[model samples]
Target: MKIHDIPGFPNPLRVRVVLAAKGLLDKVDFVPVDLPGAEHKRPPFLAINPTGTVPVLELDDGTYISECTAITEYLDNLDGNPILTGKTALEKAMVHMMQKRAESELIDAIGIYFHHATPGLGEALQPYKHPEWEGRTYWGEMHREKALAGMHYFDSVLRKQPYIAGDFFSMADATVLGGLLFAFYAQIPVPSALTALLEWKERVDQLPAVIQASA
Candidate 1:
């Protein structure tokens, strides 16, 4: 399989972390897309993913899979012994639930703040964004607030358990890690009072897979 992605970018890094965790990092080829050049919006890349997103997984038989969650699912199950996603029915449901929350409340929220609130990639990509109605700064601030709320929610969850989805480090934890990455780039500060979440992040950073992926 060939993974098309821009290294260090949040979503792509999410996939990379999963690959590292599954011990499949060396098994696949990494194709770097010129995100700064808006190459993802062009034809050749768009053909692989109509959404024009990075981190597309191209299978050996010519199948293309987009979306971080979907790609993670495929990779996790590829060995027939799922780890990052989950195994049992309840585990699957809980992990997925937290994953969605992580995406919507944190990662995706940070994305909105970055692209809409701030000067995103550049003027070259501006045409793809929606016209500012309430004002870009106003909308950006709103998204920032949402991301902060997400952090608090996760902090509360971590206070109760060691991981996002019960005891194990699942996809939900990966999603939160990705969200924190995005938050760093977006310059969104985590609340100082969310000590549990902060400590949880330190623990995640120590994982060999995370360290490898971040490297």
Candidate 2:
């Protein structure tokens, strides 16, 4: 199989972490797409994925898979261990639900906040180069506040459970981990009430899978 992705980008990073956790990194060839140059927007690349998003997985049979969460689910089910996603129907439902919650409430909100507000890496991320989004104080401020509020909500959720879905570490944890890192990279300060969130991040960071994928 072949995987195309960008390093450090929150969504793509989620797929990489899943590959590492599933021990499929060595088995798959990881191709790094040039995001800054808008390579993904070009024809040859668009032929593979119309969305032109990072973390596109191509199976040996010529099937392509996009979307970070879907890729993680595909990888998890490839083997019998079934740890990253879930084994039973109920577990799968809960895992998918929690993953959706994190993506909707935290990841997507934070992305809107960052892209429309602070140009962190600036030109290195080409989409933010448009002047239309620059200096729009009102919307930027609103999205930033929404992103911060989402983090606060996640902090409360983490305080009650060992993992986002409840107990076992599932795909939801991976999604949340990448989102928090994005928040950190974007210079959003994690609130003090999120002690559990911080602790969970530390634990996930220590995993061999995380270190390898991040490297």
Candidate 3:
């Protein structure tokens, strides 16, 4: 398998962490996509993925897979352990539920906020800002409020449970982690009152898979 993405960014980092968790990092070759250069947005890459996104997984069988959720589903089911997703029917339901919430309420909202505020998280991330999106301010402030609400929601969820979905660390947890990373880059501060969320982040940061991926 080949992972076409630039390392260190939020969405790409999500899939890379999943690979590390599944012990599949060593098996997959990483092809860097020039996100700043608009390589992924052009016809050459668009032919591979119409969505024109990063962290696309190209299989050995000559098939391309996009989206973190779908890529994660493929990886989790591959080894049959499926610990990062879910095993039982109810577990899958719970994981998916939280996963969607994590994406919509947190990651996706932050992406909109940051992209509109400036291209590529602006000065937060070097070499990601495109010339077109520079100095362009849209409805980013509105999404900033939305992202803050998302942080509060997740904090409340963490206060009630050991993990985002339930007892086990599922894909939802990874999505939240990625969102938080993006929030940090976007300079969206997580309030000091959200101690539970901070504690959860600290705990997950120590996990072997997360540590490996971050490294």
Candidate 4:
């Protein structure tokens, strides 16, 4: 399997963390996409993934998978260990629910601010080409504020449980980890009010898998 990814991008980090957690890093070849030159939008890359998103998974047979969640689910199904996703039926539901919330409330929110409000990259993103998100400048700011609130929400929840869904480390944790990392990278300071979340992040960061995947 070949994973088209970007070093400094958060979306690709999500898959990298999952692969690390599953101990499948060596099983897949990691290909770094050239983002600075808009290579993803060009011919060869687009032929593989019309969406032109990073972290695309290409099978040896020539099939391609885009979208972070789809790729994760595909990889998780490959092995019997469902710990990263969930084991029980209820666990699966909760994990998926929490993952969706994190994406909507935090990850996508931070992405908006990063891609739109930030200038150089914003101009390169070609937002004008997609009119649906034309006025996203203001929307990105709004989403950013909501993302901050969502961080506090997660922090408060972490105060009671060991992980996002519960005591078990699941996809929810991975999602939040990637999201928080992006937020911090984008200059969105971690709120001091969420002391528990801060501690939890420190613990998560110390894991060998997280360390290796990040490296």
Candidate 5:
């Protein structure tokens, strides 16, 4: 399989973490896409993923899979043991629920703040963004506020449990880790009172899979 992604990007980093966790990093080829150059928006790359997004998985059979969560699902299930995602029905539902929350509340929120409020990747990608509205900065600020709320929410959850969904490390944790990565880049500060969430980040940073993925 060929993984097309731009290094250091949040979504692509999410996929890389999944691959590392599943011990499948060595099995796939990493194809770097030039994001700064807007190569992903061009024809040759758009053919692989019409969305023009990075971190697309191209299967050996010539199937292209986009979306970080979907790609993680495929990798987590490939070995049949299902570690990152859950195995049982209840576990599956819970994990999926938390994963989606992580994406929407934290990851996507920070992403919007980065793209809309900030300069984003570059002027090259600006045309692809939404038509600039009069209140665009206000909208981006709202998203930043949402991301902060998400941080507090997760911190509250972590105070009662070790992981996002429960006791075990799961894909939800991976999504939060990716969110935190983006938050750091976007200069969104985590609440100083959220000790649990800050400690959780420290623990996740020490994970072998996360280390491998970052490497």
Candidate 6:
């Protein structure tokens, strides 16, 4: 398998962390995609994923998978001993539920703010993501506030449990980690008052898989 992405990117980091957690990081080849150059928005890359997104997974037989959640599902289930996703019926539901919340309320929200409110990836990607729209900037700012509220919500959730979904570290935790990383790049600082969230992040940062992905 091969992953097409730019290194150190937020979404790519999410998948890379999944690969590390599944012990399959070394088994896959990583192809760099020039995100800042708008390479993904071109026809060649669009053929693989019409959404024109990065961190696309190419299977050996020539299947292309996009979206961090979908890619994670395939990788996690490959060995039959799924870890990042869930093992049981109820676990899967909870994991997916929280994962969706993580994406919508935090990561994706920050993405809108980052790409619209600010000069996101510079001039090359501007046509695809219009940075000049006054209305869009206002919309993006609204999402930034949504992201802030998301932080508090997650902090409350973490205060009551060990992980984002419950007792075990599941896909939701990984999504939260990725979301926090995105928040950093978006310049959306996590307030120090969210102790539960900060503490959970500290614990996750110490995981071997997270350390490996960071390296």
Tens-place lDDT digits, model 4, residues 1-215: 98999865778878888888888889999888887667788889999898887889999999999988888888887877776788889988888998898899888888777766555254455643353666867877787898898898899889889998887877778888889988977789888878998999999989877887799
Give candidate 4's TM-score. Answer: 0.91
Better of 3 and 5 by TM-score: 5
Top candidate (TM-score): 6
For residues 105-148, write the lDDT of model 1, one tens digit per residue: 99999998998888878877777766455587778779999999
Clashes of each: 0, 0, 0, 0, 0, 0
For this target, which candidate reaches the highest lDDT against the unseen true structure?
6
Clashing pairs in 4: none
Cα RMSD, each candidate = 1.1, 2.2, 3.1, 2.1, 1.0, 0.9
Lowest lDDT sum, 10 consecutive residues, model 2, at: 125-134
Give the per-residue lDDT of model 6 (tens digit) for 169-188. 88789889989998998999
lDDT of 3 by residue, 1-215 (tens): 99999988899888988999999989999999977677887898999999878889999999999999999999999977898889999999999999999999999988878877745633433343343553445566677888899999999999999999999998999999999999998989899999999999999999988998888
Candidate 6 lDDT (Cα, 0 to 1)? 0.93
* Candidate 4, position 55, lDDT: 81
The residue ranges of model 6 lying beyond 4 angstroms of the native Cα positions read none
lDDT of each: 0.92, 0.81, 0.88, 0.82, 0.91, 0.93
Instruction: List ranges where model 5 is wrong by over 4 Å.
Output: none
Model 1 ranges off by over 4 Å = 131-134
Tell me the tens digit of each residue's lDDT in model 5 across 40-141. Answer: 999999998999988899999999999888998999999788998898998899899999999999999998898888888888888776746767778888
Candidate 2 per-residue lDDT over residues 102-163, each given as its tens digit: 88877777776676677645665645335465465556567667767777777788788878
